[model samples]
Target: MDLSALFSLMGKVALITGASKGIGLSIAEIFAAAGAKVVISSRKQDALDEMAGQLRARGYEVTGIACNVGNMADLEDLVKKTVDLYGTIDILVNNAASNPVFGPVHDTSLEAYDKIMEVNVKAPFHLMKLCFPYLRESSNASVINISSIGGISPEPGLGIYSVSKAALISMTKVFAKEWGDHKIRVNAICPGLIKTKFSEALWSNDKIMAHMMKALAIKRVGTSEEIGAAALYLASPASSYTTGTVLTADGGFTI
Candidate 1:
């Protein structure tokens, strides 16, 4: 098998959300390195510009756009600016997510639940809808939704977030099945205990880490780059025949 041919993202246009840092940043870097024209988005323009500059310095084609995923107007503007820059999007990574409250579901207020669902679930769904026309134009379009192991098995103090992720997973399958005729592949990634700022609360806690280690076969927190590699597989031609698949990359934590 020609591995390079399978994985190369040359000439492809990729848009990644929440890409200023963490897993999103890792995915953007990897995709850019793989030859994709990468457009990274987050809530802050300064952070995006800094990251974009660093990637450009490394000889990667990258552009940064600031967007708050929770806002409908922002989502539309994000798509517009990306297409204006790159013509069309061949890959879309829905990595932006929110979990303002980290407690029991019973304690989660309606406001908190709305915020979580809006950012984690609704935003991805809306963005996909916005990108559908352009995605259908690409011969090898792929959509990756970043979910969580919490969506599969609920974790303590993260109830509403888990629910939103589960919805995202389901949304992936639904879009995959519906868009198959359009040749637009949709998939979800469920990561477990990655060592990112978004997950520092869990990994940094001695008690949580100790408990997680007992169940984790690898006995260590996964890295953002690890998840980036997984996203690469899904976005590249390597996963051309794969869609509606929930790939779990949690260092055997799910096992």
Candidate 2:
């Protein structure tokens, strides 16, 4: 295989949710740079507009669509809009997630658990179903779910979120197996302790950061860009024949 061709995302139309900032935005940026026409979404239109404008100025093909993934109507509209503008959805990145509860599983309220499951687990499932037609049309279809290391191993004060993520991993496998015949590759990316606003609780604390330094083989935290690169690999032809796999980019933290 030609080295450039293996990783090129040219002509692909990618829809990435929770893409205004953090891991989602990083993946969208990288996808656009790799030649994919990317449609990015977040709960806020202004933020999405800003991100899209910045990426376009860099000579990348991008569009901003504000959609709260928690709502099925929003998800349906997100897929419809993508297809309307791009003709098809070649890639779907279910990166939008919620972690509302920060207590023991036993102490978590029903409301908190519902919100966590709604955004982190249920949203992705519905989004995939909504985009199934468009994804089926693309010969190079791919779905990248942004799971977490917490899913693989429980995290203190993040019990509910971890459970949702664990469900997402299972969902990835289920879809990958079922969609294999359709040639729609599905996978999950488990990022570990990335230094983003979403993970500030862990990286921002001096004591927590100190402990993480000694725990990780790299002696440092990971970045959203690192996870984005991993997404690119799974999204591109370079990862052809790879599906139903959980690619953990955790700075050897799991080891």
Candidate 3:
């Protein structure tokens, strides 16, 4: 088998949300390196522009579009601007997420719960719908949702976030089944204890780190780059036959 050819994303256009840092940025970097025209999105324009400029300097076709996924208008503009630039979207990655409250599920406020769902679940749902037309037109369309292991097994202090992620997982399956006819593949990735700012609360704590290390088969925290590679596989032709799948890159923490 031609490995390079299998994983190649040449001539593809990918729109990735929350891509200014961490897992999202890693995925954008990998995709661009694989020859995809990448559009990275986040809330801050400066951050997105800086990252996009850096990638472009590396000889990749990259653009930055700032968007707050929680806002429907922002999402609409995101899709519009992306399509206006690239003409089509071959891969869509819903990586932007929020978990404002870090306490018991019962302790979370209604406002926090709404924010969590809006960003983590609703944003992805709406973005997919907006991109459906372009995605369906692509010869190899793929959607990769950045879910979490918490969605599979809820962790303490991240209750509402876990619920949102679980909802995302279900949404991935739903889209996969519904869009299969159009040859659009939808899949979810469940990363565990990644060393990202979003997960700093867990990985930065000595007590939590010690407990996590004991459970992880890899014996250490996972990296954003590792999750990026997993996403590359799902986005590339290598995973053409894969859809409605939950790919776990948790370093065996679930074991």
Candidate 4:
């Protein structure tokens, strides 16, 4: 088999959320590097616009849009803009998520709990539904849901946040089965502790970092680029036969 064919993402158009920085931004950059036109969306227009400029300057096709995933109308606008600019969205990366509250589940307020579920689970669901038409229109459409390793193995202080990720795992399966008929592959990537702003509280603490490192097979935290490469494989024709699967890029943290 030609391995190069498996890694190429050329000619594809990808729409990624929470793409201003961290894993989302890394995924968008990698996709653009692979010759895919990428549209990045986030809550902050300034950040998105800045990143878009950097990518565009590098000769990659990229654009930025402001979108708050929890808002359905904003999500619809995001999709509409993508279609207007790119014609169709061949790849959809549901990377936008939030964990506003941490600590015990019982101590967490209803408002915080609801917000976590809304951003992590509901937003992705809505995006998929809204993008279904464009996705089905593609000859080789792919949907990537960003989940957490905590979903499979709950953490001590991450109660509601972990629960939401668990829902995402289940959601991935449901969508993959439902969308398979359209030949739109759906998959999830469960990233371990990465050195990103989203996970700074965990990885930045010396004590917590030490404990996490002990459990990791690689003896280190994973990087955003690592997850980006995995996403590229799934989005590309490399894994055409793959669907309804979760690729754990946790550096053996689960093991």
Please, what is the whole-model Cα lDDT of each candidate in the order they appear?
0.96, 0.93, 0.96, 0.93
Which of the predicted structures, 1 or 4, would earn the higher TM-score when compared with the native? 1
lDDT of 3 by residue, 137-209 (tens): 9999999999999999999889989999999999999999999999999999999999999999998889888
TM-score of every model?
0.99, 0.98, 0.99, 0.98
Q: Which stretches of candidate 1 lie over 4 Å from their true place?
A: none
For candidate 1, lDDT tens digit of each residue in 1-255? 889979999999999999999999999999999999999999999999999999999999999999999999999999999999989999999999998987678999999999999999999999999999999999899999999999898889999999999999999999999999999999999999999999988988899999999999998899999999999999999899999999999989888
**Where in model 4 is the C-alpha error above 4 Å?**
none
lDDT of 3 at 43: 98
Tell me how far the alpha carbon of residue 109 in candidate 3 is from the true structure, in angstroms, after superposition.
Answer: 0.3
Q: Write the number of the candidate with greater lDDT, choosing between 1 and 4.
A: 1
- The Cα RMSD in angstroms, rounded to one decimal, for candidate 3 relative to the true structure is 0.7
